[model samples]
Target: MKYMSICIISFFNLIFFSISLFIMSLYFIMNEYVIFLEWEVVSLNSLSIVMTFLFDWMSLMFMSFVLLISSLVIYYSKEYMSGDLNINRFIMLVLMFVLSMMLLIISPNLISILLGWDGLGLISYCLVIYFNNVKSYNAGMLTALMNRIGDVALLLAIAWMLNYGSWNYYYYLDYMKNDNNMMLIGGLVMLAAMTKSAQIPFSSWLPAAMAAPTPVSALVHSSTLVTAGIYLLIRFNLLLVNTWMSQLLLLISGLTMFMSGLGANFEFDLKKIIALSTLSQLGLMMMILSMGYYKLAFFHLLTHALFKALLFMCAGMIIHNMNNFQDLRLMGGLSIYMPLTSSCFNIANLALCGMPFLAGFYSKDLILEIASLSVLNMFIYYLFYFSTGLTVCYSFRLVYYSMTGELNCSSLNVLNNEGWIMLKGMLGLMFMSIIGGSMLSWLIFLTPPMICLPSLMKFMTLLVCVIGGLIGYFISKISLFFINKSLNNYMTSLFVGSMWFMPYISTYGLINYSLKIGMNTFKNFDQGWIEFIGSQNLYNKLVNFSKFNNVVMNNNLKIYLLIFILWIMILMMFLMFL
Candidate 1:
């Protein structure tokens, strides 16, 4: 009862606070007000540390969404985590995660931002390994180490920012980008964002992190932790525009988008499928953000968060009803039994694919149109629309496999949508996923973006979705693919299904190679050079020196006789000379 109280109190309080923040954001936006509150924490010999908070429409709105999702997640966790003895600890960890995200949302100072950033990494590691299994531990280690790269990059950025005598990035963001040192800082910040967001070269951690509870996935991975990097880049958007770094980011994000979408199509793990979709959406956000469309990125961020959170929650319910099985092949014809949950699942999946007038449509379609009009190359354009099609492809494939085929669960399993406790938490985000996009668009963009293109060009988004959906449906039925034909061969499936072997590369592949290199170094250097020239060589030399000394000392009588004979000979020589 006491443990449940923690969940109840935190959930209700957060709901109230989130609603309050939403109203405040509306007022703040209408007034066109941005407030900066700073408190000087310490002053020492020309160095000052100040904690800074930024309150504006953007920050307030994001914070409101975060708290909203987090509260619902907590409410949902009450049922999802009820069996665990450490439910209280889980609730507290979640609360701490929300607080850290809030800190990240409002802070303008790099020092405070680092606190929030590190808090996310640390707390996420705790949450990921909460199940106390080797799989969870491995996932946590991978998640933490991959993020640590970004942490180091950000720390370097902080150190370089010392030249301006302040850790506040806003004061110098506008003008200092041209300075060489500041450019370096911008690069570091972008790298940090890339790692945190799980962009290409660092994307192996997101799906791996599904070892955590589904509630954590709903709150942290889907909504908060992954997006922290994008939000930071949005704040630093001015520095990234028209730079080589942004150009590079655009390419990398586009590839990540393609890679994730392709990977999801070949995956069977239900949670990993959604996780890959999250990764694909992140790539979309990063792609647009890199193109200087920060507003669109943030808009998509909010909208994607709503639906993606719901998607995870619905998946959680299904997984729960199935008695913890997550394999897509092991789940079939579930829509027949769990109507409400299936509807939510289908709607969220459709939203992810940018179904017409849904939440994703408003943001994703607009991003593609704007991207098409940009002065970019055909390769970049292909990446955008092709990734969009792949998104639809994988999403449709997931829904079909999970909801339409013969029942694949165990004979004893009885599926139903009767978990009112879990449904209540999902219901909040479910409605938001439907309307959050339109409302956010109207609120965030004062003047809607004017997009003009030819008819076929305009139809490109719909065209791809249709084609991809058809392919997704037909491909799943293909005996050729299921029978391990050309495209389904061991090598090809292994490559695409494993996120292009990113998990292996980012985790054990690199690690294994590194350990081998260290072993070789030990054989070549430590054992070879140091052993020969250092201790062993010193022992040999000392042995020889000791032997010579021992001979001279032990034969002291002979030495004295030799000395006497020499002395007499000298005397005789002296007499002869006289």
Candidate 2:
């Protein structure tokens, strides 16, 4: 316990250091001169790959928030993980994750960025499987493999960068504007980002990763792992701004947001609901980014990190008190028993739903307003708003089931108010969640975006929230059987409840298709054609030659005499020619 307390204090020191550095970096931000620290690793005749670190307002500001949240999480985990024997290991893993994120934040060189990127994937896998349970193992494998796809894509992008003679992308983004190689690099980079960020096709891993401890979830889902992709895209936005791939990213990101939002409404597990919410928010970040609003996307990333981390920590408290049960059906009236944790949870949820003046409003509401103003296709228009409404829909439903309904846990279960460390963590973030958006908005946006839209478009967010609230209320209040009996509702429920079958498609569908293709190739090409022409055909020819030799030898003296006479005649002819 003493060691844990000391560890928490050390993290506070990191927070202080980051804050001071951010203030110092502000001057450089104004001058727009990026600070670069470099050391030569190797210099071959014409090609040199050097270690490089980039410092700018964006990296510093984002790093500051990441440090603050990570410090709070470390403090919170002291109480949350106190019962575990390997608490020190957990804390160290969390620290390693923070370090990896910092490295990623400061790297301008694709080569250096890979170190950080791979560190994130490797450390996250360790943290995810920390529990040593079957569920944790499976989740970790899924998480690692999914992230590995991104890692490979990033490596390919780095290979493409060799054409530019430098791995430092900051120097080449503008120069390589219309180059085809750059286009391929941009596409690969987006694919990498999509995987790390859990966008669409790679979305299943984020939710499955909830098998890790809650504190890890709070950190990974909220800030570190998922945000890594958004950070990369923020850096690469200049190159991707006008590409068709950006448009495709816009489509996929919109679908991801809508799909996750719908899935959250049907999810019963409390942690999973929160995980899906993270996915939804990630989609929001990616969608805004695809539109080239990198700064705004980054703004949301920071604010979302605050509230989502707080939300997960609050859920940790609930799960702790409930004997580790995560089902919303087994939880209710927790507010009566643990008022502080409940309040924090509600605040985080409200913030997530974009309650005015909360952390999410500054970013999420602005994102919606911007989307509405953009001259997008009708499908994207509807998706943007519908996803926004679904956020409220699931949030309200979760609140009703977990916080306000009749007591659902076992009579023996006693909700304790003993999470001093946990509450301390939540208090800091709760305060931030309430004010982070407004504070960041002032700091980052010199002048808020000016949108002159019709009154209907302006108030669309409010109207959707209200309608979503009412629908969410009715759905939660009504009996499950009544809702399930209807055939249409049943179908819709199955579709939405299963995340539109994304998990099955990504996990089973991809594996099945890949295996099928591999098997067909092996059978038709490697086994059939290659075997017939190379190995099998060569073996048959060798066997026929051996049989002919054996038959000639078996013809005894006659064959030998004929061969000798022919050889003698050939020898005499060669001598005469010589």
- lDDT, candidates in the order shown: 0.91, 0.88
Candidate 1: Cα lDDT at 314:
96
| TM match of model 1 to true structure | 0.90
RMSD of 2: 7.6
Residue-level lDDT tens digits of model 1 in 138-211: 99999999999999999999999999988888998888878888889889999999999999999999999999
Candidate 2 weakest ten by summed lDDT: 479-488
- Could you say which candidate leads in TM-score? 1
lDDT of 2: 0.88
- Across 44-77, the per-residue lDDT of candidate 2 in tens digits comes to 9997667889888889888888888888888888
The TM-scores, one per candidate, come to 0.90, 0.87
Query: How many backbone clashes can be found in candidate 2?
Result: 0
Evaluated against the true structure, the overall lDDT of model 1 is: 0.91
lDDT of 1 at 176: 86
